[model samples]
Each structure stands twice: as structure tokens, then as C-alpha cells.
Target: MIRKTDLFSGVIILLGIAFYYWILGSYFPGKKIVLSALIILNGIGLMVHIKYFDSYKKGTYVTFMGYLATLGFVLITTALELLEIFK
Candidate 1:
């Protein structure tokens, strides 16, 4: 079962990202743009999960893990982008 707190937390996390980007609308190029798009898509997927979280019998652990995994992926990709690893 999904709680209200969980839904709020998920929405807040995504809104924060959107706000951050809104405040800093720097342009990206090539691979970086693709990576950023991927991150944004991941957030959209998470919102879908948050919306229908209670429908799944085993949603709690799966949802939390998905959140963490996406966080880790974004962190790693951001670091790589900052360090120009993909270039």
C-alpha cells in the first residue's frame, strides 16, 4: 500500500528537478542533451509509478528501489558529464 507521504515525496522530488532546470536553463549539446532527456524521462516514469503505486501488490519495495536506482544513475551521469568523461 502506498501512503500519502510517499506520493508527496515523489512529486516533490520531481518538481524540485523541474524547478532547478527552470532556474538554470543552460543549453546542452550532443550526448549531454540525450542524457538530460533520459533523466527527464525517468522522472516522468516515476510520476506514473507514483500515480498508480497502490495498484501493484508489491509496489513498495519496487518503487523505492526504482527511485534509488534512478537517483544513482542521474548522479553518475551528471558526474560523468561534469568531468567530460563522454567526450
Candidate 2:
């Protein structure tokens, strides 16, 4: 059975991915900020989940994946910003 907290975490992760895709592919300033905020919040939620959900291996794996996703977002955004500056 999926706990409410776990379900919330999954929703957050999905939102983060959607935000990353939209921000990285388009030029929407508002969405960029919203997505960035969502990612940070999702990270926090994942950390909390990790601490409380010791029995769930899937939570650990998802948290790790979330960290990677956040890293990828930062790298892609940085590269894009640098490209703009250079041009």
C-alpha cells in the first residue's frame, strides 16, 4: 500500500521532471522559476522520505534518481546560460 506521503513524493518528482523539460526546451521565465522552486521542494521532500521510510527500497532508489535529475537540470541550465553569454 502506498502511503500518502509516498504518493505526494511521486507527484513532486513528476512535477519536477515536467518543469525541467519545459524550462530547458522553451523560453518561459515564469515557468523556469516555478520549476526550479518545485525541484528544490521535491529534493527536501525526498530527504524527508528517506529518513522516515527505511523499509522501502524503492524510496531510496527514487531519491537517488531525484538527485541525479536535479544535477542534470543544473548542468543543462548552466550550459545553456553560458552559451547565451558567449554568443
Leading candidate by TM-score = 2
**Which tens-of-lDDT digit does each residue in 1-87 have in candidate 1?**
666645655654564465346423444455466555555655655575556545543656776676666555545544543444244
The residue pairs in collision within model 1 are none
The ten-residue window of minimal lDDT in model 2 covers 78-87
**Per-residue error (Å), model 1, residue 32:** 0.9
lDDT tens readout by residue for model 2, 1-87: 766665766666566556556555566556555655654665666576556655454457876565456445544544453443344
lDDT for model 1 comes to 0.53
* Cα lDDT, model 2, residue 71: 46
* Candidate 1: C-alpha RMSD after superposition: 10.1
